[model samples]
Target chain A: MDRAIAIDVSHLSKSYGSHVAVADISFQVYAGEIFGLLGPNGAGKSTTLRTLITLLTPSSGTATVLGLDTVRDADKVRHVIGYVPQERAIDRFLTGREHLELLAALYHLPKDEAAKRIGELLKLVELESHADRPAKTYSGGMKRKLDIACGLLPDPKILFLDEPTLGLDVQSRLRIWDYVRMLKARGMTVVMTTNYLDEADQLCDRLAIIDGGRIKTLGSPVELKVGLGGDIVSVTLKESAKIPALESALKGQPAIRAVRATDKGLDIRVESPEKALPAVLEAANRLNCGVEFIQYNRPRLDDVFIAHTGRRIEETTPSKME
Target chain B: MKEYWQEISALTMRWVRRLSREKFSMLFTLVQPMLFWLIFFGNLFQRAADTQVTQAPNYISFLAAGVVVMTVLNNGLAGGVDLLFDKENGFLERLMSTPIHRTSVILSRFIFVMAITSLQVLVILGVAFLFGVRPATGLLGIAAILLIGMMFGVGLTAISMAMAFSVKSHGDFFSVLGFLSLPMIFLSSALVPLAAMPGWMSFLAKFNPMTWAIDAVRPLILSGWSEALPHVGMVIVVMVIFDALCLYGGAKAFRRAMG
Candidate 1:
């Protein structure tokens, strides 16, 4: 897809004294695409997002939003971008509509125009009936919806969501996901950070897998999964001792690329699961090890992370995405 | 520039709306100083608040200016509290991410707290009327009293906002507030004349900005403009310097915190 660059972050690093929250990293987000920073907690997702939105200055390197430098033209950048923080940012004392009105006023929206926008945003978030109720009374999902509505008051060109569905119930999560897709459909570039593997895979157009304050890899979900290594046939042997023997026997067979013995069983990587399944079972039988269980599917994003980091990021976080 | 004012007014009105919703807090804020300090405590010491000692027609008249200044001090010192709560709850981050003028946040708070303090001053002056006391200088005298209170408030509010930016937690902010407010009120001429105090306490009162504010406002209520003029001039100069220093400190802390 040919799209103009909405955000360009080059060699960015943010540190606080001895602790580095975001090490040197660089990536670009194309306009109208949903770009995600996918990582477990404390992986510098928030710091990078903060810098891009001009909330925090980078320690080194530079970033531009719509070709405006983030630090030097922070004010100009703010006018064009919307940010929904990781934490719930609603004022409990203010009603949902009041929150939108306050933001509109901050943005200097004209009274007549602001009124119309507030009404439309309230409806957009499905808070029309509860718009006048104080946010303290809102449920977790409702509060979050109002928060999103407030962010959209400026009708920004790009929206940054730091963990958009974090702590949301399943139904709320789906609703937020739909809202994000709607934003993209309207040609608004969406940038988000998430620790949920499923969220990155399902929601993002492209994702940068971050770990230890650095981007381990960056690509589309499909490209990342395919690049990890194609179809995998997992063979579990009843006798754990014979797993390594079975692994060596399966290596270099037809369609078999590599074999690794895991605690539970043996995972055989292949060009295709259909072709590799026969070789895997045949090898297990020749080793005289009972093939207790076998399963195969297309490689997942987690395997891509495992390929790069030598560890599972899913183990460090929680989610259906995990 | 127009957007700056819009931002400030909207945020200030937010404070007003929040106060309106909290019925209990609204009532207490308006009536607390009047009931506990002005009416009860002022009368409890009526006999001892002599004309010679207080330099006023009566005890209530003397305490009126004192209470007005005291209210300004309390309101201004606690001015940063809402911002601190906003910071704790992550609203400050959301606000900073927007294009609104950053100074609007601090200035709106000063405006709201000073406005509330002026309202409290008016209420105290009206209550003093019930105690058979009137400002010897009249309506202009009431205006001067508010002016001095505001000048004093600008400085105190700046310091509080600075503290809010620097502190690690809300608990810590309140702790510092208590540590600073009580001693300042007692050490100044809020409850009694500095001359009526011990030698050491009176010496510290000489240095308290609250003492300068109260002394200036006292003449407005007790005597005429000629007598009040000098004190007002001294306090204004003091407030200018105090506000400058506090604003500088607040700006520095804000830059560090925001960065």
Candidate 2:
């Protein structure tokens, strides 16, 4: 229970009889930071979130939010944490203003206070003009904005967003990210889960790369990219079968730290991928392998997923049960 | 408790706003019971020269109380289904993560159904008054109707939510709810007098909480508060027990769903 840690999950696990939804995952989200749980669907992200929000009791281990046990002090935890679920929470039958007003009431805001908060949230989400329209008439993005507005109705200490931008258009997704950043700027701790690597890289101050119900790695975007130990040289091959030839040809190079074949191409880990590229290209040309594409960039979270799990992120299908 | 009341009032108003927003849906909920009371009861009473022996005096009066009870039950039970759909659609989980009390969730739903059904009940009562069925209980009867209806509505809402929580899909929820509503309605002396039923049916009706409710309302509707006090006591006790059971069951279901 460190003062700076808003959410402290210690080996938290949740199982249903035989199926383990989240298995012994541990992480800490510091106060006033945007912490992302990056994982595929059913990869224990939602279960971890549910546990933190006190929606489910952990099968083993413990989690505390704002110095309160997520289980024992659930009511208190609930009071401080605002959860924006993956699905839209807007009651289509309710108008936008009415929706916000109802949520404001749920937070025990007095009539005048609730009205003020509703007005503020509606304006913040830019739905004030459509405040009186039924939510059913709202576009997907507007509904999403309203949903996020509802989450912020209580001005919580910490916010848990479960796939906040899962199905939204790019504009809506960025808009949500903007609000999440604003929340951070206002000293609110934010915990979000997403499978999108770009989102995690762009929005998260610190991120946990989760897969198969466990923490694969945890670091800031730059820290993780740096921790990958070197640059990433991705060479897209014209033929899938040419990967072995390319790997063998580059294996003896001292600059090539690691080599692996991906569906898209062969990835070479080196101290400096740009400096190593000429050698790699020479090897590929000597091996009679055609290179369709090549690039040198800092390691991606997906590369980290691959580096640790020995599997690509895109191919890692989430289990059906979770 | 202050927080609870605040949340409840807020949720209650939310439903009121929704009702206003979705006037067509409100009209549907409002018209079905009225139609049941007006057309079917009106037609039955029109041919009631011989049927007066079964209906006391006016047939519409007998049917009005029954329709009110039925409307409350249907709306409350189905409100749970809507809750389940909201869960499936992810609204409930989102709401729960807010600082709102868990009880407020149930209260809001109960308030919604009660508001909808109360409006419908008033419509039927108004039409009943027009049909020459005025009770001497006057304001007392209206209070009793609102009280009993609200209790029963909340109780049924709890049961429906419990079923919705226990079941995985709306279809299953509806199936179980439909199965329960019919027996509960039939066992109660809603449509027929308990004395006229067969021996076993009469015995079942005597134990049915619905029977107690209808009996309680019958006195208020027919001759004000002249009835014995035991029936009122029985109705209150049954309502208490049913509401407690439903609330307990519903809370358990909610816990499981959240998990």
Candidate 3:
């Protein structure tokens, strides 16, 4: 709605017959920010991103990229936006140089400028030496670097990377993450989706955690973690105990908000762990029960996810978003 | 207009480079038509030469012209299979997302196939000359026939691309292409003269546009024009209609892909 937002979607939904792939989702990504969509395998992250990129039409609602309607002004959107799909789509028979050249031609670049830009991008991605090798001969990391370079060829204002590092090794993944930071430094707005929570924490300035085609929560990594409270304490009970007794014992504690049974243990969300843990241990002692474990680390993204979804993100093997 | 020209130039250049890297494919394109020219048409003309069935001095000249057009049709229709592979492999999606004019892709492919088809025609004509069938239409007739051959090529290219979207696999698409081309060639006056055939075959040949094209070009190979011009006009009209149908079909496929 305002000048700062780079992308906006309202009540977007997509359905194939009776199956809903994405439903009633709304969010905005601001300019010059690395915004991330964090979700599990079938959380409608790709579908939502595809709709925003104008690859798939939404069944209802509207999406805008750079102040242009995705459906009505798709050509304008395509001109200014670059999309790096999850699947590697480069021609394997073409060399890295040829791939970039073909992509530049597709973008309608003048031949001289296209060649110049390809040279710069090759150097930027450190693939200059291997530019003449066919993409099929390049390692996975090299191919991915070329793919990124291809996406950057048009000098897009906002780029969408759908699982940019889905199957790369740690070193290659880190390299991609590093370039993403550089892209941000150059004032490019990037929208990325990944199942890897730590990637969102390390790379994204702000993130939205989505589940079952809905935004569960949105904020910077630290903001979301801090909002979940300061520290977490776990107690794996050997046997089930009286619910009322345990609740009453922990009631007067200063920072503890709620305690519930998790699969591995009893979990507690608290405002401050340093002051809350002593009381929790003392309560356990009085109940003649053992505190299996107590940890005083900051809340992780998994905790943030569990707080909202009432289930672990990894436990559900997502076959389809529908 | 300039931008469209630039896009066409760039697309055509890329394919030119691809063909250079794919020399084996060139040989493959030449062998089928060449064999058909030398073998089946060779036997038909040899018998016709001994007998007096055709009005033309040599049946080889007539058969050679038909073979050249048929080669263009086969090669051009297969361009659709290339497009289908491009789509299945994600190349088309990548292309559509870019800023280039979509029409340039189809036109460039048609031109690429035409260029190769024209060269194949030259080879067939050279062989026919060596076999004592001088091309009486000379350079002008050769140019006219090649242009018509290109029209035929563009028509088939567009139709195959349209079918690519509807078909499930590359193999199925090629099978349909074969089914479409073979019958059209046989039903037309490609291998034999219409005068020598049965009434039913002659009627079918009259209706077949491939017959029109062959009938048009055959006169040039035999130093005659009076009979060829009318058939040439008919072939041109039919090619335009097929081109329109294929263009509309390709556009529908694109719209479906978009949805």
Candidate 4:
């Protein structure tokens, strides 16, 4: 019942002159799981992926892909790993099929087998209709699909998708999400890095929340939300004057962990919203505070991020948010 | 070794395919050298027969070998432009991340540059023949010209690729390329013979590898193997040393960048 490790990065650090891009990071990706490095743009997510992909050497520590040392056995490691970098790597002049065919050759795939695989990948990415068109003529989503097909050409054991959905439209992003799920269904281990909290929550089996080149917390989406120890209860008051009284009354309840006043309401962190809702309502009634509305929110990945990093993911990546 | 060749062939084919698709690039690759031959050098030395600076029947015959060597030089030195674009666009990083033999990246580029330069050499030679210049050594001499051009080209291409990785931006890369290539072309015998240049210019030309390549190729085109064979031998030795030094430096720069 033991899970196999597809990627093992231990104490990996990378520095550029005086700037440390990745600082003493360690994590493991189990086979068949979509592991995610969740962080903002400068959080060393791409840097970690780059180091593991062997495009970069770590300043210290070790990383192994399918048990091959990324630095010493880079060629062997690369053989079993597929990497789709943040930037599109397709040649604009080549058709989608030509791009895949070229990559198959680079991976040393046999000619007939490469041809067959290219055909299959073209259909899989839904680019069969546009496969013969020059990549420059393809839409953004088509080009991205071709890029993913290129990464998948070698039938790699572990696939690294670095910001795979960055700069993509919602539909395009969803299409990539489906591809990632399909990859996982086929039992391919995927390591994806993204600043999108929803992407990490929806796609990843487990994720490490990274910020400032360090891991703030790591676990499954459900585990991370559960680890915050409660559901969130946002109670809006009819008047701002009711805030102080609601805050005191809510803090008195044993089910409630913490209470803070927001601009529009009182946010109560409690063990169970179902049990605490009535108690919160009772507390507000006793305090003579008129309740305008109450919203019961299960802790989101964003809340988990905020709990650990003291800043919302959106706040950190303001520019990148759609 | 088989895998090595496969990797090099695949990568080289990528470049070749890209070049083939760009009709303008293919046209310019062939035409640029011929333009220099016809418009600039051909016109400048048209009256060389009336002057004592030349020994050949006409200036185009002497300039034929120079044009071929110039094509090699231009192709080799500008070879890094593609690599620079690859670096800028992230394709180079993608290739580096693959299971390829790292040397294949540089070797494939060298192969691509040589292939294009060879074709350009033929086009120049063919055009030169129409203007009354024939290689005295026949097909064997044409083979020698390709060998010498490729030998000298390997070194220049390596150095150009090295600069592509070492520099920060496209502007810097092209500026450095222009700085190095223009001086090397003018100082070498690509435009005129060593006798045609002033004594100081000729002294510098002896140290120029392009000068040695021209000296080796010109006689095969104009005077046959009897006079050209020794210079061919000397040029081969010089090219090997030059290629070794440049390839070493280029590979080192590449490793540093990858790190």
**Highest lDDT against the true fold, candidate:** 1
TM-scores of the candidates are 0.94, 0.85, 0.85, 0.90
Query: Any idea what lDDT model 2 has?
Result: 0.80
Expressed between 0 and 1, the share of native interface contacts present in candidate 1 is 0.86
List the lowest-lDDT window of 10 residues for candidate 1 chain B. Answer: B26-35
Task: Give the candidates in order of lDDT, highest first.
Answer: 1, 4, 2, 3
lDDT of model number 3: 0.79
Q: TM-score per model for chain B alone?
A: 0.96, 0.88, 0.89, 0.94
Q: What tens-digit string does per-residue lDDT give for candidate 1 at A155-243?
A: 99999998888888999999999999999999999999998889999999999999888999999999998887787788887889997
Off by over 4 Å in 1: A306-322, B48-52
By TM-score, the best candidate is: 1
Q: List the residue pairs that clash in candidate 3.
A: none
Name the 10 consecutive residues with the lowest summed lDDT in model 4 chain A: A313-322
Candidate 2 lDDT by residue in tens digits, B91-116: 77877876677778777787678777
- Model 2 Cα lDDT, one tens digit per residue, A1-322: 3547777899898888898888888888888899998877767888888889888889999999988998888888888878787756678888888877777777777789888888888899999999998889999899888888888888888888887887778998889999999989999999998888889999999999888888888989888888887887889999888898888888869888889889967888888866798899898888888889988778777777787767766534433223
Ordered from best to worst DockQ, the candidate numbers read: 1, 4, 2, 3
RMSD (Cα, Å) of model 2:
4.1
- Candidate 4, Cα interface RMSD: 1.1
For model 3, residues B1-259, the per-residue Cα lDDT tens digits are 8877877877778777766666687577655657566556676657646336656666676577778777776777777766687667556666666776757777787777788778877877777777787777678888888888888777777777778877767888878877888878878878777887899988987877677778788887775577667777877888888678768887898666667
Q: Model 4 residue B3 lDDT?
A: 80
Best DockQ among the predictions, by candidate number? 1
